[model samples]
Target: MALYNAAALIPSGLLSVVFSLASIFNALNARVFFGEKIAVRVVLAGLLGVSGLILLLWDSLTVSFDPDTVRGIGWALLGTMIFSWGNIASRRNSATRTAPIIANAWGMGIGAGVLLVLALATRQPLVVPTDPTYLAALLYLAVFASVIGFTTYLMLVSQIGSAQAGYATVVFPVVALVISTFFEGYAWTATAVIGIALTLLGDAVMFGRFGRKRAGKILKLT
Candidate 1:
């Protein structure tokens, strides 16, 4: 819904930043609902990750007070918060011993059903794409992007808690750029390099890989 509403109204960079805020939301939600301690590293790493995103997107970034832009930002952020909450819900379900694969399957199925109902309500025609290229892209997204991505992410949440797993959301943009550089011929810039460094540093801090002892001191699990 966020992308549907805002993709044309705002820069892709802005949308990515908004969506990447799942880390902070997940940490807060976990702290409230599960009594998980709010590790300082979680917040600090999130800040670093957001800074990296800004730099990475600096060339194409935009700022405006226009109503359309503001509305788009709002929608994107609202959707991201909802997604963050969903992540915590999945974690809770995992805690109750539900398998991540099964949980993910049900979630996707139910979401698709809801979308189908909404399309019918809006009188939108549901037409299957026949183009081979489109079909191939859809298959890649369904298998590699959705099924594998969500299953592994939910497993991470179950293992390390949602606060930590949430940073995976922040790190994904950098991963995408890396993949694009190989397959899509993306060019790198000095600014983007520094941004990637910061993002990696943030991940290290979040995962206790920065300086094993120091990160352990800073990132306490509660």
Candidate 2:
């Protein structure tokens, strides 16, 4: 997923920096917070993942950044930290807490409230589309991505385990690329194609079939 829109999301120099740091933090947290042992193979997997990300980001090196880009990067980092902490907390606390459904309900409520406050404080309009096409898009987002996706993912985590459930995110980039190709006529440079291929292939090696096998090894006992 990071490979798909990463061209637009990050400036090239910052891609490896952000990814490496975030992943290091997450890996460290897995050891410290979750008491999960990091194996040699896992470390190799991480290296491969980073290599793939670098390949994916090779094109964005020439782009320059503005204030908006800086601000977006800051927000992205903040969100990454929050999400990392949340994942650790969820794994540690899930056994004693309510199911993911209840947790998500509370999370969504809090998230909406936070967004509302931020909008008000920033004096920004909570823009709603007047067009029927946008209205339909909103409805689809609300019903599918916001609701069904959330609930179903939680259920999948409970049943299949979080590792397998998390892999679904890897597919979104392909979806986004397809959409971009059709709507925006996204031209694929050779480098860009290689990046996508590396991203997908590395992601598969890290989290697709091999990931499922690894997860199964642990989950079988559960």
Writing each residue's lDDT as its tens digit, candidate 1 over 41-93 gives 78888888988888887777767869999998888888888888888899889
Highest lDDT: give the candidate number. Answer: 1
Q: Clashing residue pairs in candidate 2, if any?
A: none
lDDT, candidate 2, 114-214, per-residue tens: 87997799899887779999999989988898777776766655554333334344344445666888999977777667766755654555556675576
Best-fitting candidate, scored by TM-score: 1
Each prediction's TM-score versus the true structure: 0.90, 0.66
- State, as a TM-score between 0 and 1, how close model 1 is to the true structure: 0.90
Worst 10 residues of 2 by lDDT: 161-170
Q: List the candidate 1 regions with Cα displacement exceeding 4 Å.
A: 209-222
lDDT score of model 2?
Answer: 0.57
